[model samples]
Target: MKQSDIFRDNADNCLQLAERAEGKPAYKRYSRMADAWTALATEQDWLDGEIPPVKVRVLQMQDT
Candidate 1:
């Protein structure tokens, strides 16, 4: 959950960067970050019930 939240936060930032790139060299990198965030989310789902609550707490910090 922590990983997912961090990934989600970073993905949001990367998407913003990608939007600004709009024809620049960094576009691909930002796009890839967004994809990585998706992969993280999928992996978290596959993790089933093993995730730690501390991790989730950490992820929540990203929003603050």
Candidate 2:
């Protein structure tokens, strides 16, 4: 299995925890953790070359 897959699995687990959380604080914390894990998975995919890197477009400002 790939590292990204493991990270995704961790994210899923965090979601589950959030679902079972007793209070708003716990739920929010777990949800944020899941987001972080998901981000890591996406970054891993980019590092592994499974997906293309995101391209940024810069716009030039016009002088008024």
In terms of TM-score, which candidate is strongest? 2
Q: Which stretches of candidate 2 lie over 4 Å from their true place?
A: 58-64
Task: Please give each candidate's TM-score.
Answer: 0.58, 0.87
Please report how far candidate 1 places residue 46 from its true position, in Å.
1.6
TM-score of 1: 0.58
lDDT string for model 1 (1-64, tens) is 4767777888888899999995867899899989998778657755755554344434444655
Global CA lDDT of candidate 2, please? 0.99
Best by lDDT: 2
Question: What's the C-alpha lDDT at position 49 in model 1?
Answer: 53
Counting clashing residue pairs in each candidate, in order, gives: 0, 0
